[model samples]
Target: MAKPERHPRKTIPAASGPTNSAEEAKDGKDAGYNAGMAVFSYIIGGIIVWSLIGWGLDYLWGTRWIVLLGALLGAAGGFYLSHMHGLTRQGSSSGGSAADRGPSQDGAQ
Candidate 1:
């Protein structure tokens, strides 16, 4: 019987540490979740504070629209400020060291 030819196999580099791609992805997800939660908290807090102020003003001025408008503005501003802060912090942290090392698929580089 004739022997069959075997194809060569490809080899991949082994991981050196306990961490892997899945763990990194999970960590990223957790960080995003935390950031989102922080923003939500800020908006909710602003809504409560603004609602009180709006109610007090409406009571004195006898205008209902002012309260609604104030609450809306407060919520928008709070969300914007929170989001900006998050971006600033993320930018600062992501701009240094590891992120600048190479071309990363996740855009961290």
Candidate 2:
């Protein structure tokens, strides 16, 4: 048996499409791409730095457990930093773009 094609339940009319939606979507896509790259870099960088530190400490102290601990700590710190510095900021910026700002009070002057 052949299957039928599926389509979206709702449709937007071409004549009434949002003015800046396309631009906003593109901006969002770019922002998301950048954020993903930054977050990945952060995680990898954190892991490598902390693991190195842990390895150094183990070497100096002749212990075998610190490297795993360091990696965990690094992962946590990376997530925290990425969230604080990138993801949250990106969300706020995307939500409050120039188009959404309407107008400024100084514009009347």
| lDDT to native, each model | 0.78, 0.83
lDDT at position 14, candidate 2: 72
Best by lDDT: 2
Best by TM-score: 2
TM-scores for candidates 1 onward, in order: 0.54, 0.58
Per-residue accuracy of model 1 over 1-109 as CA lDDT, tens digit each: 9999999999999878637799887887888788878888888888888888888899999988877877897798788889678632554445576646567678663
Which pairs clash (backbone N, Cα, C closer than 3 Å) in model 1?
Answer: none
Once fitted onto the true fold, the runs of candidate 2 whose alpha carbons sit more than 4 angstroms away are 1-24, 86-109
Candidate 2, residues 1-109, lDDT tens digits: the string is 9999998699766785447989778887997898888888888889999999999999999999999889988888888899888563635543678768777668683
Clashing pairs in 2: none
RMSD in angstroms, all models?
15.2, 10.9
Residue 33, model 2, lDDT: 91
